[model samples]
Target: MIRTVVVAGALLLGIGVVAAQQDALKSAQAIMKANGKSLGGVLGPMNKGEKPYDQAAVNEALNTLDDTAKKLPTMFPESIKGMKAEGDYSPSSKIWEDKAGFTASIATFAKTVTDAKASVKDLNTLKAAFPAIGKSCGGCHETFRVKNS
Candidate 1:
């Protein structure tokens, strides 16, 4: 009876750990998506001249992106996959297979965001630099993300 109880306790503990990891993964992904949306909110209006460009908001968004980029590599530890999160979005297995490449891509994106934050004094500068940022995001997604089916 003691052996059975111990086994059951171990199983429950394992399930709890898995659930916690999944929760962490979900939180991380949500933060990333929110940061992306925040950046988009800043960029879209400036791009279309729908509103006067807010340099402070742009800088804040870029900084958030940079911060997120720094955390990103560690966020997708190999164990994150196969965990059940409520969201359908997940990292591609290619991330683990080409960890170096994934890290490099994120590093490049972070650098671009830093540069943009430093140099974007006006709309024209943003226009010139934003596409590179967008490309960096696209490149990473193309190589390392799998959209929900």
Candidate 2:
């Protein structure tokens, strides 16, 4: 029957939409994880004095952070807004509830990175500069990211 065909078509369309949203979520999460690992891997050891400070590495990590900040706003689409946070890198639903706050966090992160790039010249400066960068990341994560339970 024509009605049966239409029903099946509607169901297929719904499934396709869900699948697309899942793909988008996974892609966004991967980008975040890579950025986090890249930055954290470099700065974390340096900050702890476990690894010698390397300006080139710091610069590269900051560049990654800069690019990630620009991509942050677009990663949260409407389709993924209400999805349950399942694991690491999952965005909180509060992101939609507080769009301006979320945006402000990104701006803060970008500015901190710019400052770090300008100031981090030596080990002492790297140590001095890292707290703000870490704070920016932690603050945003606290407000916008859903930690795994």
Candidate 3:
């Protein structure tokens, strides 16, 4: 009976580690998504012609996005020392499930961000950048993120 209890405790601990990691990843993703939405809201007026594209405002938005992008790599759960595997609820498996496709999607995203950042000076150029930006996000969400859950 004591041995059985010990085994069960170990199993629970392992599962807890995995679950915690998943939670951390999910939290990071949520943070990024929230940041994106906030920036998008700020940029929308200029894009929609509701307000003139203010270079200062646009630059601010882009700077925020650049910061967000820089923080992205750290959020990924590549490794966590001392964390035990408890359970798993990540989209990592899906993200890498089709390795080639995933790589292409991420590459496209990076390129889109790079182009958008570089073209921040001109409203017309910024407008042009929107499609690529949206496409990059849509591609990842469709494949890696869970549907509406």
Q: What TM-score would every model get versus the actual structure?
A: 0.89, 0.87, 0.66
The global C-alpha lDDT for each of the candidates, from Candidate 1 onward, is: 0.80, 0.84, 0.65
lDDT value for model 2: 0.84
The RMSD (Cα, Å) of candidate 1 is: 1.7
Off by over 4 Å in 3: 1-12, 64-93
Ranking by lDDT: 2, 1, 3
Best by lDDT: 2
Q: What is the lDDT of residue 46 in candidate 1?
A: 83
Q: Compared with the true structure, what per-residue lDDT tens digits does model 3 show for residues 1-149? A: 99999999999999998787867766665766655663467666678787788888777776666665555545555444223223232354554456667667666766767778887677887788766776776667678655332
TM-score top scorer? 1
Expressed as tens digits, the lDDT of each residue in 2-58 for candidate 1 is: 999999999999999887788778877887786777557777678668778888888
Q: For residue 138, what is the lDDT in candidate 3?
A: 65
Candidate 2 lDDT over residue span 39-108, tens digit each: 6888888888888888888888888888888888888898997675446557888889999999999899
| Candidate 1, position 45, lDDT | 71
lDDT for 115 in candidate 3 is 73
Better of 2 and 3 by TM-score: 2
Backbone clashes, each candidate: 0, 0, 10
